[model samples]
Target: MVAIEFPLPRTTVPPKTGPILPDVLRSEWDKLRTVRSTYWTLFAAAATMIGLSAILCGIYVAQYAHLSAKDRALFDPASFSLTGSFLAQLAIGVLGVLVITSEYGSGMIRSTFAAVPQRLTVLAAKAAVFAAVTLVVTTAASLAAFSVGQMILSSKGIGVGLGAPGVLRTVIGTGLYLAVLGLLALSLGTIIRKTAGAIAAVFGLVLVLPTIAGLLPGSLSSVQKFLPSNAGLALVTGSHAGKTVPSLAPWIGFGVFCLYAVAALAVAGVILVRRDA
Candidate 1:
């Protein structure tokens, strides 16, 4: 038998099918919308932020009705005692915590991981969707607060509008601040996985730490202004030149909030990719 050597056909190398970020983003967005818990939380955030903001504004406006022109000029009473936001932030934080923890609670995280096996992709997707939603809702609430608050204040002969120098900026900036803070909470929850822990952590970061510093002796007050809540709040103000005020400028204050978000998300991203869901 003559054994003829057949020519070997060339083998083809498979093309690299890397993960698509945009597709993952679309999938995540769909997940967010269909998820009932997410909707509820978002609704809660919007309602609390807008509703309580208006109420608080009304309360303070009524109290400040006796203010002289100079007192009004020197004060941003309209922004103060958003005192409601202190409580409203708790709602926003809870929503942020649930956004991730609920998935783990329902064991849906396994399905999410199976579909989008690239773990970091899932984390990134969640962050983007949650952050975007927060920004929109917060901006709306802030604007509503400004409008309704202004109307109530106007009823008390306190007229402040978007054109009132820093009024518009403050209105918008406070919204951005809350939204960023929400993302930070979400990032914290993603890493911790325990609702209580994340909630406590966020509260400590947002409220407790600032309070602690403010209560410190005069020696510490100067340095405490650099904390997330204190420094970050300046973004909503036109100036911070008052005595004993933060050395942090408005933009810099907002930057501190960004740093908190970035650091928390980075840690959570690392854990999500390296650890099992």
Candidate 2:
């Protein structure tokens, strides 16, 4: 007798999940928060701003009497305190690059793409989460540094209030600058997919290029204002006193700086979509 084979029961797969930007956002937020580098980098950035500002302001407090007229004229309590922002930018920028590159290095990117499938959405989520975090931390740090610096200056009878001209703008600008700077690094990391190279590219654009540009003729010095770092610094400082070259207005310079980051991210997006993981 021939036995008839029974048909196997069909298993229904729950339909694959639909696109949920918020879910992608939550997943990215979790990834960012779980990483040790996130905390360490944020701490370093804040500490540098607070510690360095205190020292600089303290020195000014001690030397106020002996400071030359030119020195006093060049001094900006807000700008001086936020000077640590320069160093902080380096830390955050490196952290941003690491945020993306670390995944590539550890082969986690494949898993990330496997889960998300939409590569651009993954990058956008990473960017939105990272940008929000950096903005909060850096903005708070900048404000604290400004407050501490101003308090020190107050002891010397030279402190200015938050309501003072450009004071608030400068403080807020520090955070904006850093947030965009980090975005730029993330974009570069996506394009290069290497930590060291991305970091080098960021610093070279922010720090090295300015120095190189300075070597050019004074007439071309105006061109330096377009560089990411210089434009950003101009936006935050809002002053050109004692400078050999003039910078654009605070908002204008910031707009220019943002364009640089936007350009890089736009390119990264195209590459991410068109190229293989």
Candidate 3:
């Protein structure tokens, strides 16, 4: 007897999925917001930016008459308001490094990569989310600080208008500078993959490098203008008759500073893909 033969079961392949950048961005954003460090770091940055600016402006107001002519001549009310950025940078930079390094430290990076196999995409999402958040928060804080400082200085008739030459640029450029600084730190974190080491490297580059460069001979000291912090600061403290004397144009210096961050990110993208998570 011939047994009835059943037809072979038909095989089917799963439908292919297209790239979903929004999903990646959403995931990165969720990861960033879920962590407590994000709130604490951002709070610290905001408080420092506003608090230090107010306090510093108060000191300047009180000491206006006592300051030597040379010191008085170089005082910039706009830059004074943004002075908090120096301290805020540490907070922003450290948090930026922690954003990625913490994942590596906790072995969560592997899971992230498993969920999103395109490593550079993951990096880009992180950078984009962090940069956007930083830009908003820092810009608001910068504007507030500037307004408050200007109001305080107005008490002494030394306040400048937002419309004043270089004033608006300094105020807005400060926020942009901080955003780029955060991106640079994030790139370094991606490359180093360790929290402490990455923080140290970033801080060293930002803080120590300028100090070291300052010690060079007068002829070579011009090199300091090209340093990342110096160049970035140029955007926020452009040349004023009696204040900061920027060697490069504000936009030019900012462009140079951007190059450093871009170069670091490009290198990080290459290393991230070539190595295991």
Sort order, lDDT high to low:
3, 2, 1
The candidate 1 region of ten consecutive residues with least summed lDDT is 238-247
Report the C-alpha lDDT of model 2 over 1-277, residue by residue, as the tens digit.
9776678555688665776788899999999999899999999999999999999999989989998888888877788889899899999999899989999999999999998888889999999999999999999999999999998999978888889888889899999999999999999999999899999998998889999888878688778878888887787888536666668789988898889888989999999888888
Candidate 2's C-alpha runs over 4 A off are: 1-18
Best candidate, TM-score: 2
TM-score for each predicted model, relative to the true structure: 0.84, 0.92, 0.91
TM-score of 3: 0.91
If ranked by TM-score, best first, what sequence of candidates would result?
2, 3, 1
- Residue pairs in clash, model 2: none
- For each candidate in the order shown, give its overall lDDT on alpha carbons: 0.75, 0.89, 0.90
User: Which ranges of candidate 3 are over 4 A from the true structure?
Assistant: 1-16, 68-73, 242-246
Worst 10 residues of 3 by lDDT: 239-248
Model 1, TM vs. native: 0.84
